[model samples]
Target chain A: MDSIFAIPLISAIVSIAGNLAVFRKASFLIAGVAHSALAGVALAIFLASISIELDYFLVATLFAIFFALLATTFSKFSDIDTGIGVSFALAMAIAVILISLTRGYTAKLWAFLFGELFLMTEKDFLYISIALVAILLIFGFFYDKLIFFLFDPEGAEASGINTRLIDAIVVAIVAIAVVAVIRAVGAILAYSIFVAPSAVAKKFSKSVAQSLIYSFLITLICLILGLIVSSAIPISASAISAFIASIIYLLVAIEKS
Target chain B: MAIEAKDLSYSYGKTIALENLSFKIDDGEIIAILGPNGAGKTTLLKCILGLLRANGEISVLGRDPRKDKKVLNMISYVPQRSSLSIDLPIKVLDVLKMTCKEIDSEILRHLELENKLDLLFRELSGGFQQRVLIARALMKRPKVLLLDEPFNGVDVLSQKRIVEVLERSGATTLVVVHNINPVLHAVHRVMLLNKKLVAFGKANEVFRRENMVKVYGAEIPLVVCEEGVVHPLYGDQHG
Candidate 1:
């Protein structure tokens, strides 16, 4: 594979793994975290304008994890539905967008929102690689436990699985993976890549392991296809990737029906 | 005792689910927890399993269930069939593999699920789903097995098969059921509850007319059939 394909390959790996781990378990929350990450990106930009240097990926990951945790806690403790957390995320996203405009960081904001896949720096590649490795390692170590937890939480808890801790770890891993790939597939379109392939794979998979493998393959195919089409035409790569993912999902769904 | 609870109480906000519930189960004893819809049968099981916080004390295998993680390894719980989603693309074997540390082929054979291992859980009938859940729990060879509504959608033949398997396994079993007539012969003890311990004794002692009326708050038609005792309010069965 060419060095040019390395970044998107890593992004696809992380997207599929994170989506399988988190999206299947907490679908709405992943979308909420993806949108809420915009607030973190805005904050990082605002800090940079004030002559402070920080890792925007780390900042965005922390913010997304915080929002995810907040939502999980509220849903677990209070009578409020988990979807209520999505409203908070949307509110934060809008607030940060307005703040970014006021600070004259509109161009930077658009890059984070729509993504500039071709502009991925060497550092972005390194960060995504580390995230991919970390995600794979965690999943490898806790594959059975995670599957048990996701399949039957009550049964897992009864069997001494520490489901609450597992849930938090899953959310954090997803948050980091989503933030790490934001440069390759923007905050706005990240959820599409994260969920679509996994959802499609699940339609035909008979086991968790098979579902994961199918998810990775589907995501890689969509990424490669999107990159090829966008290179030929004057279209956004991330947008095309998102479109391909949705098309694949629809095709699978139609076949199933 | 395999399981013990003292002054156990749990409430959801202002609505009390269980109040001052106390019980003890000897090792290898099969006990059925009989109660109405909202009598906190599930709540009691959750408390014992440490899934829900409750006031007072609960000990499983001589350790506080809330403090010791090892207790869980020795306990197998089958939640209500409705609490699980069969639509997920999970095979019956996949569920067993994820849950049991060591699968017992004999238990699977007893439940007649050995042949259905490759089937998707969603494709099984309700009775077969319950059998799969039971098979998973039995595969663990747990010291204590807790089942909530194990026979809700189960048919008569499957129910008999399940009771026979449980009776032979000799695990300290606590089963929560709305009706007790099916497993009356298999159970060593019967616990009647209505937000509190109403009756705790043998099936004949707890299944009396007064205790039934007190627990159910209405007249429940009961009869002595060939199967032992039958609660006609739930269903009819032949032994």
Candidate 2:
């Protein structure tokens, strides 16, 4: 109802939809992209202190996209996997820590790292809504092709699908989703939303479409429950959402066992 | 020619997988490519399908496969079983529906997979998975069909059914097999390869003692039966 609730709802939608597109392996890429956003934030803060007056969201989105693209492209061209590209995240983490120490902006850095959803501005709400719409449209249009590629890449390519282009688009969607929700879920907690809900859905679903629907429902439940719990107690909403996701995953695993 | 390759060579870094390979397939002909392990059998298929970048030229349906993607629409490729992950949560009918606009009920009935359309692909046995892959390729009504090790894990009955289906399809079919016995009667010609085109002709002409020894690096005794020449080396292993 309120614009404040729109932030969590939109984040849940983006997380569920993005996870459905890339599946669980995408969470690793999200972690890499999210952590890499720290470098962009550091650069933005540095530029702002000198009166350059740039939008931090734009800088962080561009930087995170660059790092995400670099990681995927490097892994594809070389004989390595996406895990090797995660080194960029570690490097950015160190850079952000050093910059915060020297610039005495530790609180600002923590705001990005831990997330503060209560401080979401009207502009942030608009950006999240636009991202959710974009994600919905892209996934809706490419749903079948994406499923084909994910199920069997060789078969998809053999069937005249542009697998490389599709792969790049998938990575771009992931980068955008991470950038859109980084402020609400934080760089550290965002991966849980992308991964845990999908993991639970997979355990209960027999088809890709079913898994997608279940993932959305599970993420929405977790986000709403986390919001309620955090309202009554002194706790982080993002942390509570992550906790709820993990507890659901555990419950599903136990039920399956 | 439905498919033509001129001096097509491919290398994995410094290691050469295929070298100076040249071949042609007539329209509506069935050809089986036989080779030992790492003889570039799969590499040759990938080059023809434009899945790999080769040194020389390859034209499928009179267009360069590497330059033009339109040729891919008329061609269907069934890769080795290893290329597919069985554990994916996808239904048999869903796989067919994704690859083709309409399901060919006749092909499904022939493959005996019509009843198992709703089953998860992973739940099927190895033989059924291969049949499903074949059925998926056939659903496209492709002019040029390429299969890599289609009988790797298939049972004898399914193998016979696949051979019969390919024989009746009338498509330009190129199949790569480790064993040449099952497909000997079905294939119009056979191509033997060991990093190079060793032999290409009728099955009787190519399955000689010297060519078999050259490709397989061992003495392979052939038995002339009512069906055809059976290479004891590969034929009996599956039986």
Top candidate on lDDT is 2
Q: How much lDDT does candidate 1 score? A: 0.78
Interface RMSD of each: 1.8, 1.5
lDDT (10s digit) by residue, model 2, range A122-173: 7777778777787778878887888788777788898889988777767767
Tens-digit per-residue lDDT, B41-152, candidate 1:
9999899888888999999899988777787888899988776645667888988877765778888888898899899887899888898899999888888999998999
lDDT of 2 by residue, B1-239 (tens): 89998999999989999999888889999999988999999888888888898999788999998888888999999988887655657899998887797999999988999998999888899999898889999999999999999998789999988988788788999999987767878888899999999999988888799998898899887777776554445546646
lDDT of each: 0.78, 0.79
Fnat of model 2, as a fraction? 0.69
Give me the runs in candidate 2 sitting further than 4 Å from their true place: A1-4, A15-26, A77-87, A90-94, A97-102, A254-257, B219-222, B235-239
Worst 10 residues of 2 chain A by lDDT: A78-87
